[model samples]
Target: MRKSELDTPCILVDRVKLLDNIRRYQGYADAAGIALRPHAKTHKTPEIARLQVEAGAVGVTVAKLGEAEAMADGGIRDIVVAYPIVGSAKLARLIALARRAKITVACDGIDAAASLSEAALQSGLVIDVWVEVDPGYGRAGVLPGADLDRLASALVPLQGIRVCGALVFAGHSYGAETDAEREAIARNEAGTALLAAEALRGFGFPIESVSAGSTPVGRFASAMAGVTEIRPGTYVFGDVMMVKAAALAIEQCALTVLVTVVSRPAADRAVIDAGTKVFTMDGEDSAIGTGRGYVVGHPAIEVAWFNEEHGILKLPDGERGLRVGDRLEIVPAHCCAVVNMLDELHVLDGDRVGATWRIAARGKVK
Candidate 1:
């Protein structure tokens, strides 16, 4: 079967590009002497995660416990739950997962560590955890120096939980407009994580892993000293946002939405069968242009507007060539979000349908 024969508004992944992307990033990690624990949130497919492991990734990282459970069920043994594990119910689940795999969770406070310790002790398991450091995102991590020191001091007495290292998500690099800015963000991420690790070691804590970087700064952070591992989720499937950030070329985008032009309302307007439901509300960088996605073959055309189920295209001047039933490929602004909206991905071998892979962890937010 061909892409054209598939239903409208479906996701397609180029198998060749997918494997090439995995090998490319793995090669970078290997050359930089850093371990690659790719965040599995991008595809949420265990098959892809296994591919990364086969390509030399030390393990896989996940944003949620449910995602970790999914990967573990799929036969992955080394897993990092990048989010802080909280609550008695969730802790029970975390301990259960630890029984089957090597689980390293992220913690931001002494209270979280204490809870993890209690749960692990109850289950007769020791859980490895990383202290999360904020890399300018003001998200879910403590700052380096005093903030980190305080947390470490309080955590030292905790039982059944050992602080292994510091985890940094330099997600702020996603907003960088140039290569220099990305490099700076990467340096800051590396510096912040290294500072935290050094401070912890000064406090007599055995620090081993310094996991840092997002896809935007993976290359820079991986090459920096003291960072033992990097977690880049979106490198496996490039998107328009990565293109805008200058981290990936459009051709490197392995995932694309296949949609059919259902209506041509005017000379310069046409509508496709994909919209916010297919491609999330995530938009491209405004400085570069305005669109939720990039038209694969039509540069001038823009996804001018969108509704819940339809995308309005502003056709290029003098081009009324888009007719009903015409199909087009779109690179979404955020591949991770786009993928989470789907239940399965139709993988393409060249232009023909190759196989279908279930998004094993789709909507696994627990």
Candidate 2:
């Protein structure tokens, strides 16, 4: 089908740009001698996950069991659930998944490790697990040192859980304006993780993998001495936030939402068919300037605000040329969230629709 025939609010991925991004990241990982495991939560499509693996990703990292299941069903063998799987129902599903694929999970607490171990024992499978260390985010990870050591020790007694390595996410350093600053923060975080791993080693545990990454931090993290794996998801489709934050160039952005101007409300105001539902409302917390999104083709037009179904566009006083029914593409402020909001994505090459891929793992929170 032609690009124009696709439904409104549909996610569009530029196939060429997406492939370029994949290769660029893979090249970095290869040169750095670290395994590239692009997070599948960004695209949530098994086809894209396969593409990543084909592009030299050692495996795919998913944020949830449902994503892992989808990738497994699509023939992906090496899968890592980057989040802790708790509760009986989710653990049961995780155990079932372990039987089909080489699975790994993240744990930050004794209870979670014990639960996972029990589940793995029940399934009669040994699952590789990583200890999530909190560098600074203060979210879902054990603090370095005593806390982490406690969790690692607790996992030793678990029958089916194997401590694979340490995982640290350096997301808090993405807003740095200078390259030196970003690198410094990344080095500090990596150093801290390496130290923690050394402590674990001193305690007689083998540390196989030292993974740390965030799209912005990954640019400098490749230089860290001990990191063995780097997981950065958004680098696959650079979004407006990443571009403005200096993580990627405009040309690197592979995703855009096609919207038609529905109204020219005033000389400086216009309205587009895309809104909060289409363009994610995640720009407020971004390091870049606050805005709904950026008009892909019109550099001067700013997406000032968005309602549930309409986007308010503000054109420069004398730059109001867009008329009603005019189609314009927009790069979302955050591509990952935008992907989650849609059920399918249209793969396009230039203006032609190349393929259609379902967002199979959308809303897989459990």
Candidate 3:
């Protein structure tokens, strides 16, 4: 089967480009003397996760216990849940998972660590955990310098939880304008994380892994001497934001939504089958760019507006040649959410359908 034969509003991944991305990042991590643990939240497919492991990723990072279970069921032995697991239900599941694989979790506070430790002790298992250090994201982690020390100290001698090291998400470096700025941001974050790790060690805690990195920051994070692993997710499927950020070229984008022109309202306007439901309404807040997704192969065609099922395109004055039934590939503004919207992804290699991978853990938020 070919991509042209697939139904509209479907997710399509370019096999060759995806492999290139995986290999490129893996090579960078290998050369930098760091472990590559690509996040599974982006692709959420065991096949792709296995590809990363085969390409030299030490393991895969999952955001939830359900994702970890899916990967484990798919034969992935090493897993890391980068989010904090709090509730008893989820903690029990996490401990059970630890019995099967080398599973790890992240903690940024005392209560969460105590819960995890209690769960592990009840299950007769020891769970390795990373102390999350805030790297200016202000999302989940504890403040790096002193706050991190406090949390690490609180976890000491916990029955079944071992403080392995630190974890920082360099999300602030994503939209940086230049490579120098991005590198500087990653270096600063990595330095702070390393300092916190040393502080934990000084307090008699064993710090084994100092992890940091995102797709945009991976380029610079790989060069940071203290970072032991890079956890990049979007590199497996470059999106419009990555392209605009100059982190990836247009050809390197592995994921796109296949949409058909369903309405030609005017000479200079057309509507595509995909909209907020398929491409997602994210990454469009910048003052410097147009709205939502960008039409692939049509540089001048801008997705001016979108509803739940229809995307309005504003074609250039002389470029209004699109007709109903004509298909156009759209690179989503954010690929992660788009992947979650679908149940499966069509893998393609230069227009020829290669394979179909089930998105086994699309909406497993628990």
Candidate 4:
């Protein structure tokens, strides 16, 4: 298979670039004296996860139990369910997963902790737990201080749960418009998580792991004082968001959508085969020059709109270099979401096409 032979609206991952990203992140973590447990939700493929582990990743982090089970089935032993899993049916599967591999979970409240403990106790497993700290994401996680201590204290009475330490996701760091702003958020993520870890320790709980993760923060991981683990997903496939934030380079982008120019309706506009279905509505970035996605080689073109199957492209300079049947490579704003929209990614080792990697964890958002 070759790039020219691949159909439009397809995904292509440069193997060399992918391997480079894996090793680069691992090297950074090694130099900082921290473990790199990459988030598998980015690629959602066991093949990629294995490569990450082989490249010195301590383990893999997943956003759901379904993804964890898929990775575990794919032969990954050390897996962390980064999301809080609740309910009996889900807990049963969660515990069953514990029987096969070492599992750690992140929970923000005592209720989540108690439910996890019940699941662990049912399976007769002592699973490690991380107290999620709200590092300004306002998503999940309890704030540090009384809430942190309270969760740890609640876990003390639980038979199957052990408080490992603290974890944080500096998602707000992604919105940073400048290097200084990004670095500032990175420091905040590390500092806030460290405070929670220290508070957990002050309560006489054993604080073994302090984890902070985000591609933006991962760039300045050295700011993470007292952090023992770092998990970054998008570093594997630098998207438009990472590129605009100065966290990644355009050349470092490993994943892109192969689209074909299907219509040249006007001189200032054209249409491509790829649209929201392929590149998705990953949306805008402050630093990125375009919305939805940016054409890899055609800076003169902007992806202005999408109509499911059609991509509305515009030329700011009014120069129509694109013609009907022309193909374009798009670096999407969010590679993770773009990946879930597809079943397989056509891979490349330099110019030669490699075997396709199945999205083993797709739709496993349990």
Candidate 5:
């Protein structure tokens, strides 16, 4: 069926644009001599993960153990749980997941690594782990100086876990106001991880992989020497936030939410069927332009506010032709969060619905 004929507040992904995005980034990684490991947290669908793997991604990266499980069930053999997996309950699950695939987990401290080592020893399986280093994100990771030295020393005695290398996330690049600033952040991110890896190797640790990158800084981060792999998620489906960060052009946004104008309360006010539940509240703290979402082809229009089930739009002046039952496409502020709010994505074949892919890893927060 045609997109216009579909139900309101549904997702639409352009097939041609999607494939182009996959190939374009894969080509960049191949030329840079760095492995591309597309983070599955963006699409969270096994089918899209397979497409990335087929296009040249060495494996897929996930944010949680549940997402890793979904990918493994979908026949993906190599997976990376980029986040720390703590707690005994989760260790058991992580060990079980290792039996199904070559699982690589991350840790920033000796405690988590020791826990993983104990679990792997009990399961009689060696787990590959990348030490996550803080790249000024102020999130979860050890600093690149004496602290990192201490952690590396502490983890060296863990027999059940193998220290692969260091990893960094250039997430702070999202706050960059200019292209130069973003590139600088990317450089620092990769450099920090590489430095950590070098220190680990000097400490008699077998440092094999140095993974770093995010969608905003993936290109610059991958170009840096010593970065073995780059994990970018949002590059597969561009969004308004990415456009604002100068990482992607607005036209590269393949995924959009198709919503219908449910009511024209006033000449300047138009209400949509979708709300925060659909588009999410990701761009609230941004100093950049645009509101909750970017209205496709309607530059003057802004998503003024949203309730659970209602989206308020401020229309442009002059001939305001938007009426009830009018369908509008919105490029969400954040594609990853928006994808998690849906059950499936409607792939478009031109103007018709081509296929529907299940969001296999949505809500897999564990």
Candidate 6:
């Protein structure tokens, strides 16, 4: 098959570019002497996860138990659910997943840890856990200090829980305006997590791994001292936000939403069949650029807004090059959200269809 045969408003992944992304990040981690365990939440495709593993990813990181279940079912041997698992329903799945994969869960609070410990004990299996440390992002994870030690204390006494180490998500790096700023965020993330891990170790907890990752701060963050693993998901398919953040060149973007022009409403505006549903509204602060999404190679065009199924492309003054039936390639603001929105990615190697890989963990919000 070919690109022309695919339907509009679908994801197109350039296989060459995809493979390039995998190898590039893997090579970086190898050189940095850290394990590369890509976050599977970014792609959600087990096939792509296999490719990542083949490229030397030590394991896969997921944000939920459903995703871990899917990856483990797909034969990926190791995974880490990077989010706190709460409630009996989710814990049941988490414990089940632990039987199939080398599972590790992250949590910053003792309450969640208690639930996990109970579940692990009920399942009669030992569970490894990482004390999530907030690297000043203030989203999840305990701050690096006494708070982390408190959580570590709660887990250390649990018969079923093993304190592995610490994990930090350098999400704030996305807000950085320059490479130097990103590197600084990465360095801070590593240092912050290390401080908590060392503190935990002081209490006699075995701190075997110090995990960290963010696409914008990929190599810079992983190269930080004491970081044992790097989990990067967006690097599998670079997005417009990454390009705007100077994380990758526009040419390196492998995933794009292929949409067709449906209306040329006026000289200054046009409409495309894809909308927010196709290209989600996720942004990385300034990394989203000036438009809802960047029209690839069309700097003069801006997807100014999107309805449920209509994308309004605002054209530059006196520039109406697009016609009603023409197709456009859209670089989304967030590649991970785009993957979740689609059922399968139309794999392509420059205009020719390679194969379609189903998003194995789509809608696995649990």
Candidate 4: list runs displaced more than 4 Å: 286-288, 316-319
Q: How far in Å is the alpha carbon of 319 misplaced in model 3?
A: 2.3
lDDT of each: 0.87, 0.82, 0.85, 0.85, 0.87, 0.84
Evaluation by lDDT, superior candidate among 1 and 6: 1
Stretches off by above 4 angstroms in model 3 are 285-290
Clashing pairs in 3: none
Clashes of each: 0, 0, 0, 0, 0, 0
| Candidate 1 similarity to native, TM-score | 0.97
Model 2 lDDT tens row, 278-342: 77687433234436676675777777888989999888865697899777777888898889888
lDDT tens readout by residue for model 3, 1-366: 988889978999988899999999888788889999999999889999999999899999999899999999888998989998989889878878888888989888899889888888888888898888888877889997677767766777687988887898868787688888888887888887888789888878788999888888777656688889989898899887787666788778899888899999998889988878887777743222545766677777777888899899888886788889999887788899898899999999788999999998798779
Candidates 3 and 4 compared: the better one by TM-score is: 3
- 123 in model 5: Cα distance from truth in Å? 0.6
Clashing pairs in 5: none
TM-score of every candidate: 0.97, 0.95, 0.96, 0.95, 0.97, 0.96
- Report the error of model 4 at residue 208, Å: 1.0
lDDT of 1 by residue, 214-317 (tens): 88887675456778999998989999888887767888889999999999889989999988898878756323454667788787777777899989988877
**Per-residue lDDT of model 4, residues 1-366, tens digit only:** 778888878889998889988888888788888999999999999999999999899899999999999899899999988898888988888888888899999889888888888778877788898888899989898977777777777767877888877899988887878888888887888899889988888767788989996787786877777889898999999888888877778889999898889999888898999777877777464245666677877766777888889989887765587789888888888899988898998889766688888899988888
Candidate 6 deviant stretches above 4 angstroms: 221-223, 284-290, 317-319
Name the lDDT of candidate 6. 0.84
To one decimal, what is the Cα RMSD in angstroms of model 6 from the true structure?
1.6
The TM-score measured for candidate 6 stands at: 0.96
Candidate 5 lDDT over residue span 1-366, tens digit each: 788888878889999889988888787688889999999999999999999999999999999999999999998999989999999999999999999899999899888899999999999999999999998999988988999999988987889999987889877888888878887887888789889999999888888889988887766754567889889889898888888777678888899999999999899999999998988787632224447787888867887888989999887785279999998998888899989999999999899999999999999999
Give lDDT: candidate 4, residue 171.
88
lDDT of 6 by residue, 18-134 (tens): 999999989878888889999999999899999999999988999988888889988898888899998988888788777777988898898898888888888899899888988
